[model samples]
Structures are given as C-alpha cells and as structure tokens.
Target: MKYMYWLLIFIPITLVARFGLQLNDGLVFLFCCFGIVPLAAVLGDSTEQISLYTGPKIGGFLNATMGNVPELLICGFAVQAGMYSLVLASLAGSILGNILLVMGMSIFIGGLKYKFLPFNKNITHNNFTLLGFAAFSIVVPFFFKYSGGGGITEHSLSNFSLALAVIMIVLYLLGLIFSLITHRDIFDDEDEDEDGEKEAPEWSFKKSLSVMIGATVCVAVMSEILVHTVEGAAEQFGLGEAFIGIILIPLLGNVAEHASAIMMAVKGKLNISIEIAVGSSMQIAMFVTPLMVILSALLGNTMEYVYTPMELLGIIISIVIAATVFMDHKVNWLEGAELIAAYIILGGAFLVFGIG
Candidate 1:
C-alpha cells in the first residue's frame, strides 16, 4: 500500500507532460492514468480514516458513498463530454473487474495458503440476491431496445432510463438501510478481527478530511485531462475508447479496492476481501450507474440505461457465474483460476468484438 504512494510522482509528470512539454495525447493519457491510481488510493484510505472518527453506522455510510468517488468522477466527466459509450463501458467493466478479477485474485492468493476459504453464507447469499436483481435491472433496457423491434425512439429510451434511474436509486437507498440499519449485525460483523483487534485510524480527523478533499480534487482534474486524451490515445493505439474504458479506466479508478481486497485475502481475512469485491460491484451497479444516469440527464447529455448487447450479456453472465461460485459458501484456488480465465476470455471478446 505504501508503494502505491510512489505513483504520486506521476501527478507532477502528467501535469508537465500535458502543459509543460505538451507531450502527445497518448503519453498524457498514460501519465494521467498512473497519476489517478494513487490519488484514488489516498482518497480511499483517507475515507477509511475518517470512518474511524465517525461511529459505525455513519462510517458505513461514508464508506459506501466514497468508495467509488474516483470512478464516478471519471464517468461524470465522460458524460459531460458526450462520451456515453465510454462511460457505459467503464461502468460495466468496473462491475466485471470487481466480481471476477478482484475476487478471483483474492481467492486464488488466499486459497494458496488455505485449501478452502469460507465466508458468512447467509450474508453472502443476501448480497448475491441483491446483485442478481441489480444485474437484471441493467439488462432490462437492452432487452427493451431489441424487443421493441426498431420502434423504440431515443426519447422513449431516455424517459425510460430516467424513470428506471429513480427506481434504482430508491432501491439502492433501501439496500443501504437494510444492510446498515435493520440488519447491521450481519454486515458489520467483520469490522474486527478474530482476535478482536479492531484497527484505529492512524491519521488525525482533520488530516484525513483534508487529505480526502485534496485527493478528490486532484482526481477530478486528472480525470478531465484523461478524458480529454481518450480519442487521441485510442487513435494512437488503434483501439476504441470502449476498449480503453473496458480495460484501462476501471483499473485506474479501482486500484485501491483491488489492492485492499488481495491484501485482506492474503492475511486470512477472506471475508473482508470478498466483502470488498462484492460490495464494490454492488455499489457500481446500483449507486454509481443510476447516479450517472440521472446526472447525465440533468446535464442534458443524457446517458441511457441501454448498453451494447455484448456488454450487457457479459455483465449478466459474470454476475451469474460469481453468484454460483459463492453458492456453496466455499472457494478453492482452482475455482479462482476459473474465474480469472473467464475474465480474460471476456476481455479478449470485448477487444475483438469492438464497442463493448
């Protein structure tokens, strides 16, 4: 985790490349991508620190809201720029990356030490049930488009997206209530370790808030620069923005979660690792997607809920496979390998098929 802060060097490098030397867009894009990763890590860490000062319930809410701030900022900027496909692809990629790539790596690393990793079955089951519903919601607009047989108008799709976004936001809020309030015991049980050593924040509250705010502002600026370079970067690499979104952007935005989950798993805190993976995915599907939809609409560059058929199919299939993997409430290294293999195949498909 400390090593990630070394990436802070890229922040100055990106600025100098973009404005000082006026480097090529591809280089600027690459630098900004590296720059954002550590900023995101700092943002997440500071949020965790702040959560220590707040009580558990409020801390949970704070984590839930701040977990995806970097991704949301990037997508928000993309939405403003009318890069709808890029935003949508990034959202889908975040979901797949979390459930498959992050969780798979966590399980594989943890399973290497322990033959099997088990988590709270009932809690995991409930999380998956909500995840399944979220997946279904994501696919509905795609289904609506095709099922309409070319009769659906853009206006109607926008309207549908708006309405559905409202419903999703409501449901997501209800879910927060469910997990954090009425059933807090199930979700909050892992805050402490088996030996009952609950870690305390290392930074002062003022320092945490100041660092979080600073990181967020830096991420916002970097995201703007990053989005500005997407087209040139795509052209330079002979790739599509969708490919960049599907592969690169999510990785940049989620470096913190990816690192934290794997570290937790390695330490035999597999439950915390899975929670980070699955919970992050759920937040992307329910909270981030809907918030983006509504914000895009309000900003007059509306991003519909509709997705490319291939992209939608990949998300649904990933969710199903992930859910099935956890159904037995146990996982082994081989299962983790399978999940990683699936992600690789899907990524290759997105590359070959185009505009995922």
Candidate 2:
C-alpha cells in the first residue's frame, strides 16, 4: 500500500498542469485520472483504520458507504456538468465491474489454490434479492419511457424518476436497518480468528478521520477536473464519452477497491471479498443512483432514470449472472472464468455496437 502512495505525487502535478500551465484537456485528464486512483486507495485505507475502532457492525457500514466516495463524487460532478449519458453509463459500468470483473478475478485467482470457496449463504441470498429489486426499480423508468407510445413528456418522465428515486432510497435505508439492526444475527458470521491474534489499527482515530476527509476533498478536486475535460479528452482519443464512462472511468475510480477484493480472495477470505464486491454494487444501485437523481435536480440538470436499452440490459444481465453464480454459496475456478467471460463479451458488445 505504501508503494501505491507514491502515485500521490501526481495530485499536485495534475493541479499545476490543469490550473497553472493550462495543459491540453487530454493530458490533464489523464493526470487527474492517475491522481484519483491513489487518493481513493488512501481514502479506503483510512476508512479501514477507522473501522478497527468502530467494531465490525458499524465499521462494516462505514466501509460500505465510504468505499464508494470516489465514484460518487465523480458521478456527481458529471451530473453537475450535464453529462447525463456519461453519468448513467458510469452507474451501469460500476455494477458490472464490481459483480463481474472484480468478483470474477477474486474467485478465479482464489479457486486455483483452493478447491471450493464458500461464503455465508444467508447474506448472499439477501444481497442478491436486494440487487435484483434495485435493478428492476431502475429499469421501470426505461420501460415507462418507451411504453408511452411517444406521448410521454420529458417532465413526466423526470417526475416519475424522482418518485422512484425517493422510494428506492427509503427502501435502501430500511434495508440497512434490516441487515444491520433487526436481522443482523442472520447476516453475521462467526468470528474466525482461530489463531487468537486480532489485527491492530495503525492510525489513530483522529488521524484516520482527518486523512479520509483530506483524501475525499482531493478526489473531489480531481473529479471536477476530470469531468470538466472529459469532452476534450474523448475527442482527442476518438472515443465516445459513453464508452469512456462505461469502461475507463468506472475502472479508474474503483480500482483500489477492486484490488482489495482480489487480495482478500487470494487469502482464502471469499466471504470478505464477496461482500466488498457485491455489497458495493448494491450500495451503488440502491443508494448512489438515487442520490444522483436528487443531486442532478439540485444541479439544475434534472437527470432522469431512463437508460439506453443496452445499458439497462448490461446491468440486468450482470446481476442475473452474479445471482446464478452465487446461488449455492459455493464457487470454483470454472464459475469464475464464466463470469469474466460474461464481462468481456458485454464490454466487447458495447465497444463494437455503441451504447445508444
């Protein structure tokens, strides 16, 4: 992790190039891109350090929420920029990347060393149910838009999205209470420190909180610059903004969390790895997506929930595949390969066929 922090030097360089020298948007965009990754990792580590003091239940909630700060800020900035398509595509990409790319890598690499990986069946079941419902909620707007026979007004669609966003957020909060409070016993697994050696926190609570705050602020600055220059950057690369949002931005924002999941899996902690991947995806759908809908309105952009058919299809397929793979709460290398293959094929389709 210390080695990764060396990339932090790019943060200042990004600021200087963008604000001082006024470099090309493409170059500045790339610098901000690299800079945001290390900042996100720092934020994650700090969150982990703080978690050590909070106990598992509250700590788990903190990790789930803070873990997504990078992508949340990025998408928030994009929405503020009125790049609705890019933000929508990014939301879809995030769910796909987490469940498929990150989870697949974790399982595939871990499965090679272990015959079978098993996690908590109860937790997996609840997560998939929540994810499936969230997917269904988001797509309702898409169907509503198309099913209106060209008579649906943009204002009506926006109102309907706003209503659904409110309902999803309400349900998302209830879900937290359900799993973390009312039904926590069902979700909690037995403590497994058989060696009787608990890990210690390296940073003081004050230090962890301070560092998390600073890292988030820096990420926000970088995200703003990244979104500000996205168009120029896309034109320079000859790539559509939708493609960049779907593929590049999601990977860049959450790369740190992705690495953490894969590392946990390699250490034979499939339960933790799956939680990081699947839990984050659920938070994005239930929490972040709706939050963005409200933020878009506040930003005066009025972003709607309606997505392109391909984006909606990709999300639904990703969730379905994830649910199927984890149905039995056990996975092998072949299942991992299948998930990765699914992601690659989906990505290829987006590239070759275009998002719209």
Candidate 1 lDDT, 1-356, residue by residue in tens = 66789999999999999999999999999899889988878876777678668744455345435657778998999898888888899998988888899889989888899998877775577667778888888778888888987789898999899898889889888987887779877665453434575568899999999998898899899999998999999999888767788878887877777776776677676666766777778888888888989999899866789878877888888888888888788888888888888889898887886667
lDDT for position 195 in model 1: 59
- State the local distance difference test value for candidate 1: 0.81
**What's the TM for model 2?**
0.95
Q: After superposition on all CA atoms, what RMSD does each candidate show versus the true structure?
A: 2.2, 1.7
The TM-score values for the models, in the order shown, are 0.93, 0.95
Q: Candidate 1: which stretches are off by over 4 Å? A: 50-67, 188-194
Give the Cα RMSD of candidate 1.
Answer: 2.2
Candidate 2 lDDT (Cα, whole model)?
0.83
* Leading candidate by TM-score: 2
The residue-by-residue lDDT of candidate 2 on 1-356, one tens digit each, is 55679999999999999999999999999999889888878877887788679755455457656768878998998888788898888888888888899889989999998999877887777778889899889777888788877779998888888888889899899988998789988765564345455569999999999999998899889989999998999899887766888878888877666776777678777766777788888989998999999998777667889888888888999999988999887999899999899989988887776664
